[model samples]
Target: MSATLRSIAMGDGTAPVDMLAALFEARGWPCSADSAEEISGEIQGSWATYQVRCVWRAEDRVLQLLCLPDIRIAKEKRAPATELLALINEQMWLGHFDIWSDGGMLLYRHGAMLGDDGLLTLSQAQALVEAAIEECDRFYPAFQFVLWSDKSAREALDSALIDAAGEA
Candidate 1:
């Protein structure tokens, strides 16, 4: 970690959620802190604009981050979406994609334990947010392929991964 991150994580006494808010502000990203425990922001990715939310659970000493695209899976497409989510999740090292049963909303979810201090280092918080966005952006196109283009889950995932690898 850099000296600034060390100081922010140790000396400033910032809560995990507040740290996220501060990080977003420093990046000049628009965000809102709905409460002491939660912050929501937006980020523009190559595929789409994503909604990012960070929630700090004081009781659990866990910080959760979620990144969601603007797309919604239709009821009939949920099966393929779920399969694509599973296939995509298996390839991810940091976060996993999930579809909400209630709303058919698909998102990438990740959590980090803050340990005894109940604080997140600036670098750690930044990584969590970045990982979420990266995963969502990477798979957004596959999701479109599966849900809208009638591609099989495996085919969609394969195409997305191949495209990503080529770009990288």
Candidate 2:
């Protein structure tokens, strides 16, 4: 940890906004934190551009990141979207994809516990953001396949994973 992070982690009464800014700075990722609760920015992925939002809850010692794309499921395709989310989430070990059925909004969400006794350190915050972005980018194409094509959830996910591996 850097000296600044060490000081912040030592509970120097730093604001969550400052801590978040520092965290992203340490990781060298650009962000905007004009609000106290969250930071919002665009993360460029291999296949897509995601609008990433990082929310902090200091009272609860928790952080959440939501990666949202332009993908939206039609009303008739809600069931398939739900099925895709289930299939995708099963293979995921950290974050999970979710659908807002009524609004047809799709998002990849990850939550991390900062633990009650400790400060939300720079490393923990960076890890949470990294995992959320990685999972979101990796699975974005599968969600697109399910929404735009007639592929089944299993097929879409399998194809997406194969493509992701090829990229790696």
Candidate 3:
């Protein structure tokens, strides 16, 4: 099946956090302080490097990823943020997931495993990594990859926030 891609630019006066919360709630995903705090930590940590943030969600066993770019920075730098977001957008377009954005609100994207085909399969994960690497090469160029996974719901929520940033 072909992937679905949707893009919405946040005009202004939108809070990424509030936008993300509403999106997740609208989709019936679980939202809690623990999850929010964890995602906040991840976003804070990533701010020094990439100017985007992202989040991941798994509801009723379906996985969804959200990305939010730092628009101000992206508009200023242009290439790095745009290229990185495009790569992720490509992943969504390939039937890899769902994507959208709200006014200055966090950009949002999601992926759910409707079947084995919809999941980010091993190959898809590899592709995601490669895409990220390519973007890093053009931007940071000296960045390194580190594998980390949180098997808790916190991980899912945090991922959603980071993904919303559209950094990786």
Best by TM-score: 1
Candidate 2: the clashing residue pairs are none
TM-score of candidate 3 versus the correct structure, residues matched by position: 0.27
Worst 10 residues of 1 by lDDT: 1-10
User: How does each model score on TM-score?
Assistant: 0.89, 0.80, 0.27
lDDT of 2 by residue, 74-168 (tens): 88888877898898889889888888666788888887766665356555666776787788778888888887887898888888888333533
Q: Best to worst by TM-score, what's the order?
A: 1, 2, 3
Candidate 2 — which residues are off by over 4 angstroms? 1-16, 25-30, 163-168
- Evaluate candidate 1 by giving its C-alpha RMSD to the native, one decimal: 2.9
Poorest 10 consecutive residues by lDDT, candidate 3: 141-150
Q: Report clashes for each candidate as comma-separated counts.
A: 0, 0, 31
Task: Give a tens-digit lDDT track for model 1, residues 37-92.
Answer: 99999988888889998888999998888888977889999888988888887887
Candidate ranking under lDDT, highest first, comes to 1, 2, 3
lDDT of 1: 0.82
lDDT of 3 by residue, 26-53 (tens): 3344554235311321122133222223
